[model samples]
Target: MTDHPNSIHQFKVKLINGTEKKLSDYKGKVILIVNTATGCGFAPQLKELETLKNLFKDQDFEVLAFPSNDFGRQEPLNGVDIEEYCAVNHGVSFPMFDKVMVRGSEAHPLYHFLTKISTPRWNFHKYLVNKEGEVEDYFFPFTKPLSSKIKKKIQKLL
Candidate 1:
């Protein structure tokens, strides 16, 4: 790892299977990190996120999804159930992390870093990180993954 303490790569997160992973492993890649809720109205966005992943997976673009129950108790399932739901319903194939608290005092360190850059008002909020692991942009829960605005940003990063 590098000595850059301000980088997103410095954070660690847990995968859906409970495997701890260093964000440093994704250094130099453009990452779209999103907080998802399987039971939320925006759950359908998972499919579009998967589309983006399939379209840019070979271009150093990665989508990392983290389930969160901090909003309206939208994500009620445990890690395994959440993973299975995404895979079976949305065909999600990107890296999915364990359920995390995206806001409040108990929020994960990674989310703390993310919120410092852009506080999420609700579930399905997204943070677009550049190749340098810096927060480049923030998308509200209502922003569609296929929107020209998001697509253009992803294109520029890729």
Candidate 2:
């Protein structure tokens, strides 16, 4: 996928490890961006998200999990602790970014842009971005990462 002169790539985010990265780095990849909460009832979906990452990563798919506490204080872990917990409990291997506000004026810039289309109504809300850096779909909190609908969309994107 060719990079557009101006696109989602212009936004940057901090990684779970405190490093900064521009979304442009993922240019040409199908990105599944999820706002996650470790203590939410939907937390178990993290495991399934990892599965989705493992299954399609080789095909240019990337799962970008952004821990958020904006919803009911569900994700209270600091970056390091969040990383450890996810690795030990769910065996998560996908990129986990630093805790971010998923709504309101303080939200991350990427999220601000995303919310303009469809704000996350709850934890685990997902935004699927195509290789061209355009949002193609929005999956609600209860939508399983591996659900047939999501898989079909992914397959079509691939």
Judged by lDDT, which candidate is best?
Answer: 1
**Tens-digit lDDT string for candidate 2 (1-158):** 13333357778889999999889899899999999988999999989999999999789999999999999999989887998898888889899999999999999878888897799989999998999888899899989999999988988988
lDDT by residue (tens digit), candidate 1, 2-64? 434577898888999999999989988998999999999999999999998888878999999
TM-score of 1: 0.95
TM-score versus the correct structure, for each prediction: 0.95, 0.94
lDDT of 2 at 86: 89
Clashing pairs in model 1, backbone N/Cα/C closer than 3 A: none
Please report the TM-score between candidate 2 and the true structure: 0.94
